[model samples]
Target chain A: MIIKRTKSHIAEIFCNVLCVFVITVVSVNAQKLNDDFFSPKSRLSFGNYLFLEKDYLRASNEYKEFLKTDNNDTVRFKLSESFLRIGRYEEAANNFKSLFFSTSLTDEARLGLFKSLFFEKNFVRFRQYRLEENYTTEKFSHDIDRLNYISYFFDSEPLPDSSRLFSAFADLNRADIKKFYYMKKNPDTKNPVTAALLSAAIPGLGKIYTGEIGDGITSLITTGLLVFLSANNFRHDHNFRGWLFAGFAALAYGGNIYGSAASAQIYNAGVKFNFDNEVKLFFEKHNYFLPEFDFVNR
Target chain B: MKKLFYKYFLLIEIFVVSSLFPQDRLSIQFDYANKLFQTSQYFDAITEYKRLLFFDEAKKYSYKAYFQIGKCYKAGAKFDEAIKYFSTASINAANENEKLSVYFEIVRTNISRRTTSRALQILDEIEKENTNTFIRDSINYWRGWTYIFADDWKNAADAFSKIKSDHELKKLCEQVEKEKVSVTFTKAISYFLPGAGEVYSGNILSGSITFGWNLLFGYLTINSFAEERIFDGMVIGSLGWLRFYRGNIQSAEESAKQKNIAIANKILKYLQYEYKGAKP
Candidate 1:
């Protein structure tokens, strides 16, 4: 009697285990087997993995696919941030712009849109953001204002009054900012007209003023030699040869004058390039003085 | 009989559950990614491959997924990114053949990116790693291709000749080597006698015209000096004779360089349009 009861109790437990096992197998078999691998959840998980890998181009593609089926602000922010990272600023701005109206990410997206425009060097559009979009976030307006002041240094936009531009930056950065301000205000420039006039008086004198000493000296020698040859041949009654030499001398002298003016223009271009490069480097090293957005990275 | 029936039920349940698992799902994903690849939807294919890599917890598909992603990148001509993924594939490679396959793609990428030095460097490392005769022949083949892209026909011919006594590419390289003009010879001959280098470089009319000008100036300059016209002689010598003489040497050297460039472009065109072998 005892053995038979024990056997029945053991059978009851085995039956229960088998019943649960059969239910699990049937339900699992009934569903699409690979749905878990390609479902929205897996996509988000995969997109996040690619996002963390800093493969922004691939990450953007994955995020775009994920966004097609889901409406998640964090993923949208990440997608826009990925575009920004890869220098696709237009797409980045458009994507960020989509987040502006009625979302918790409105402030970040607004800042991202402005950042895209600013980094694209579209200063005109960046400054006209409020007018163009009829949108502004009270939260990030001051940050945008800082970028607005910073943009003036990068482009040919007229600098605002010193007090206004200075007020946007912190006191700690005042010295460096003032240096850039002064550089933009009183940049050293050479006059092309003066270069031409100087070369007209003395062949190669303009080139010397433009810092091309070798070219200047070569011009002077060539012009002076032809002039001396013209004078000598004429004194010796070689009339045709003297006329030939004079014509050549006139051409060399005229070419030198024109070259001097062109050289001065080129010099001025170099000065502007260096100044622009310096400003670009400073801002790049300083992250353009924009506040760090660590939300998307998180 | 009831105990036997219970055992049978447990077996059926275990088999059903185990069969419906990640392995089957992962296999489907790999095949799906390959289908996308076959359709030339490279970017989508990469996404799918990455999808496989993401869910492959056992890492069974890691090497294949990474390799396919690298291939997609290579197809798009994004060599640097392709190289990064290929190196990653190499790291995940399960065996010698897989590693060689990854290395070949990397070297090929470097070649296409025109970083031939790096390509050769990797080939050299590969050679040192495996000295199997057949693999060495394959390495020599790529080395030949590397030299061909670099425009070093002599070395390319030498490398290919080592593979076969008369390989088609080796013959082409040799033909180019024989037909091309020599820069040093052109310059040296022009320095010794003006117009000769230009004539050798196939600039006939230019060579003759330059020769006539130099000869006329030469006579005039010597005559001026013979007549004791020192100033005239100095002017003619410095201005006319020296100008044409220097211009001859420079023009000849330029012609040689351009001829060599033409030969290189012809060979490259043949390779791009006509050759049957796999190209970097």
Candidate 2:
């Protein structure tokens, strides 16, 4: 009787365990099957995953979907950032503009808005915006100043004084900025009229003055040879040939004069291009004085 | 005994469920990636493919994922990354056909990158594998394309000729060859007469200028010599007449070469955009 009782109790316990196991398994399966992957939580996680992968377009879509039901500032910032990453500057600016009033992200959003404007290459608008009363931030003021100074290099806007602009840059970069400032103020320009006059006085002298040694030498040789031919023909009584050679010499002389003036213009343009390129490269190498944002850290 | 039996049954059920779950998830992920690829969202497709690669414990989709990643990179014009991924796919390929397909992709990418020598080397390797006639013909066809990218029309023509007697590309190549000005002929003609080669090569204004300069200088040199002015004749002949005469010949040759290149490039541009035929 004791053995049967023990066996019955054990069997009852086993049956109960089996029932719980089946229920648990069925509930878990049902939950998984019915799960909505497009929920806010799921979209946020998936969107974060895509963002980390640099799939900005899809990530922005996911963020947009999540933002429909949720209004998290960080997510909005991320959505705006995704737009920035994919070069949708106008949309990014608008999105970032909405966050300019947020307490926690106000500064970051302002910086982001500035970045969008800067990247659009509308320096005039950027300068105009920077001059607005509330557009400046105390925390990022130095960075904003640096960007403002950098803008002067790319446009015809007058640069600020050294003390104001160079204060935002590193000690090493201060020298470079000063050089750029001087170049902007008094550009190393070649005078086209002077170049033309030199070439008129002596064939190829203007090209030589403009640092085109090879072209100058070639011009001198060609002009001298034609003149010599004309003189020789005249001395030898070949009047028609002498006249033709003289005409050729005149053409060469006039062309050399025009070419010299053009060379001076080209030289001045090259100087400007080189300086602009250097300024651009320096700023790019330093990330334009902007701090690196770790959006995922918090 | 009853408790042990219940434990064993539950354990088996859990095992079956767990085993089936991952397989279903894997298929879903694979389908998601395929959908991304089909929609021409190559950048997003690459991300999905990479996700599949990370979670795929069975290595079931490794080769396919790598191949698709390569295609995405190729679409983005990132040839170096595309080549690297295609090489990985070739190594992981399950069969000879898959391997050959990857190799062909590498060749195509190389051709697009203008690395004609590398493309040709791979084509040679494929040729040595003793592929069937159709495959051989395909190889020759791509070889012709590689030559075209290299701007070697004669070799391109030869490669296409081996595919068939009168291939369309071969005919195009022949047409380009016929339309091209002969650089050597222009040089030879200019050597005999200072400006005749320029006129023959259809540079009438340049030819007239060259002829006028040469005639004036030549007359000066001859007139100086007739008047027994040795120094004047020598200076005029050597500096003015000889320089322009030699310059005319060099210019004519250079013009002919440029004209040939221009003709070839016209056909090449047409082939690149408008040709309704096989291409690399």
Candidate 3:
């Protein structure tokens, strides 16, 4: 009896595998199973739906599973785009790289790589990769050039030529772009050393120079009042009171000097913050001047 | 012997083919996704569930897939997305029963998200739609939980009382409400007497130090002016007495706030880890 049951069990396992495989194989005869939910074609279809819905994280996973069996340029590009959308810049760059050399999507892939690098703040590497002769895409060269110029406005040194930068953008955007360029060229920032020296000589002049006018006036009045009090006590022959007032005035003067230097540092930080926010707002609103591409909608 | 062989072979083929039918295959897929959910592989489970939804053209699985996806997101503590998916699931619900379940899921997520007003609003809407004993109980239970998360323990106790006067959560809420410090009283007393609010909130050492400093500075400034040292009096009063007095009031207020926070946190911790009930 045991031997007979073992033989039946082996036969059952073989039958199950064969049946599952037959069901999955969608030949003309097996039309009913063509809509199998786990099939690669269905997965790709579902992935497109998710990608269109902006559900990029799940969309990327679906694309990965579908790509395991099928090789399509649009799907690969979308997979890269999904990664980029979800801030997975490294993975996005790698996927875009696969479409670089000979595929019809070389131009799109190159632009995608540049965007990923730029968003990741890898400016040096982005420049190196963009300027590589073989890697440049002729179709998107202007877009890439504008992106490079924008990166300079963001934080890069030795900024691009002002006129060239202006010509790269449209007429409507030129005024805003020029504002960013000139702000980068000659930032309205204060020097901490100059502020400190000014304060040391005139109590609160450095704070006024750094745009803290109200605080500067208060500091000046307090120090000046203490000095006047010290002179009054000495003229009235109150030696101990005179020295106490003198001590207070000296302490206030020293504090104002240190405070003025610190104020200049804070003023510079504000300048940088405003510049960065404006540049970021402009680029984000304009999509960094990158062209629109939506595979799902198409 | 040949007849017996054909009979067994036919039985085996029938068993395999029956399980391979499209409907049964979708069931297999659902089970696979559910297994991932049960194992705490939430992200993977959502992907599989989305796949099921996409290919189940009949949409028979839409409600279940969306519902389970919401649960997975909830387990991951992503309350916003969990609520979104649960709301979607409610739209797909086939009947009032399924719709109510998804609605409660959303309310529970709102409670977890600490948006108590939204939770209460949803619960009230559910209450208006449902009057069955079991569902009423469920609604009141969640309403009570919303109050608990909102730190309105008095209302929590009242809501739970509607379910059962002696409910364990109701008693816990009552105890918490009774033990919490009164912020208004603490602030009032501090205005009347320096650092008294700190003492009321159980900060005896800080209260005593604040009182001592204020007393010393007060005496110094009074004496300086009495001795006709106007400059000395002005400086001492502005720089010493006023500073300590203002600091005392602020410190007293902070102490009261911190004491109440500690009380709330202890109960919240109990509800999170120790209480044997459905929580936010």
Candidate 4:
């Protein structure tokens, strides 16, 4: 009976061990079945991972490899996007142009091309492509129009009507846009001749009119003190002292006139600079109304 | 019975082999990632390290992978991302040595970002930890580097002095400190004598010009007053003499500061590319 019991125990142990071995082999096979390292699909997933990590160069290479076997629009767009992130605008534009005829991503690709042009500061070509009928998208018309108006602030293009120019901007930005438009249309320019005349009438008055109060005060004090000293010396019969002070007073007056005219020009330049900055910042804050790329979710 | 025992042994062997297979695969992937790192394929190495992290079921290589990812980001000059990964590595460190290494990397990244104060703060934190003498010495070494990068050669010298009297870096720092001009002293001398500070700061040409203007204008003002030409004296003294004197002081201070910056930058550039010593 004891022998029979021992034999049965040994058989049971053998069966249990066999079951464990079979489970291990099956699980290993299962894992292998799910992983296909060399396949294009896996490469695309890996590329996306790298792109998310901001490793654009490697991501672009991976997308390029995947493209050899696949002609997917999303991958193409991503490849161009990778180039765009790395500041290779020319290559990005070319890649995006290829997708401009794709059925599903044509609009996005066209917009991407415009963005590439804008980033490259080729505003003229951007405006030209924007007006092209082939590249127009009904859904994104407002964005394109906003970009059109914003371009005027950077370049020498004449601004359009306020209502039409700011129509595409959000309501919150209407006041700022209107202010910018008004500044562009009727700039607060100080006349250099007027500034010089004002300073001639009153030493440093022209600088004050040009918004340089500190310089105006200094000029007034310096010139006034010298002129007063000259008159007082002449009253005391000190001709040499009077003449010396008189000469310095004349120099101060001449310098004040020249400085006032230059100040007016500086004021006008500052006005232009501030206006340009405001318009650029407005568009930048709104991202030019462009749609955020939804590549990750897709 | 003997046949049954033989079958059982065979089955146990199969189970043991199968379980060891995944571990072996994990080690191979880890080595592959390391090889990529060694070749400077930082982006690809990052991907491989991530793969290793993903497949490592027991989390054995998790901290190591994170540390490597930090190093890759650092190589790419992405200091913010490098700090993020290094922080993760520190949190997952299994031993004090690993934690210390991650801390060192974080400090190095901060130094590259030019956030020297933040790097010093991290070093302070490392010093507070229960670390060995070797780690403490390393901390002081990097602290000296942080000060050097900030152009604070005096403080750098002091930090390196903690390592040893004859340390190479300490000597370099001391030499730089000795060669630097004192901006405050230059400005102070210029206050008493116009253009003197500029001359002391090695700008002799400018100093001579400033001195000549001050002297000419001073003579004119004094002569005008002696001749009872009050208006001429007032105008010349206030406008010409005072302006030159103030300008002399300002230029002297500026030149001294610039000279010190140039000296510091020369040493820093040498340390960055040519020095054969250990660096952060």
DockQ of each: 0.30, 0.13, 0.29, 0.18
Listed per prediction, chain B TM-scores read 0.88, 0.85, 0.91, 0.87
Model with the higher TM-score, candidate 1 or 4: 1
RMSD of model 2, in Å? 6.9
- Model 2 over residues A1-298: C-alpha lDDT tens digits? 9999898788778777876776678668656644435568767877888888787888898899899998988998999889988999999989998888845788888888888888877787788888886777777867777787787788887777778777878897788888888988899889999999999999999999999999999999999999999999999999999999999999999999999999999999999899888888988988887888887433
- Tens digits of per-residue lDDT, candidate 3, B123-150, equal 9898887789999989989999999888
Candidate order by DockQ, decreasing, is 1, 3, 4, 2
lDDT of 1 by residue, A1-298 (tens): 8998888778778777876777677667656454576667777788788888897998887788789999999899899989998999999999998998788899889999999998898988887875554557788888898898998998887788999888888899888899989989887767889999999999999999999899999999999999999999999999999999999999999999999999999999998999999988988898988877676666
TM-score attained by chain A of model 2? 0.82
What ranges in model 4 sit over 4 Å off?
A1-39, A50-58, A82-89, A115-123, A138-154, A161-183, A189-206, A217-262, A292-296, B1-62, B72-81, B109-116, B144-276
Per-chain TM-score of chain A in candidate 4 equals: 0.72
In model 1, what is the error at residue A146, expressed in angstroms? 1.0
Best-fitting candidate, measured by TM-score? 1
Candidate 2 collision pairs: none
Per-prediction TM-score, please? 0.84, 0.68, 0.83, 0.69
Candidate 4 structure, TM-score to reference: 0.69
For model 1, give the interface RMSD. Answer: 3.8
A-chain TM-score in candidate 3? 0.83
Candidate 2 yields a Cα-based lDDT of: 0.87
**Model 1 regions more than 4 Å off:** A1-20, A25-37, A130-134, A197-209, A212-257, B1-20, B36-41, B180-193, B222-230
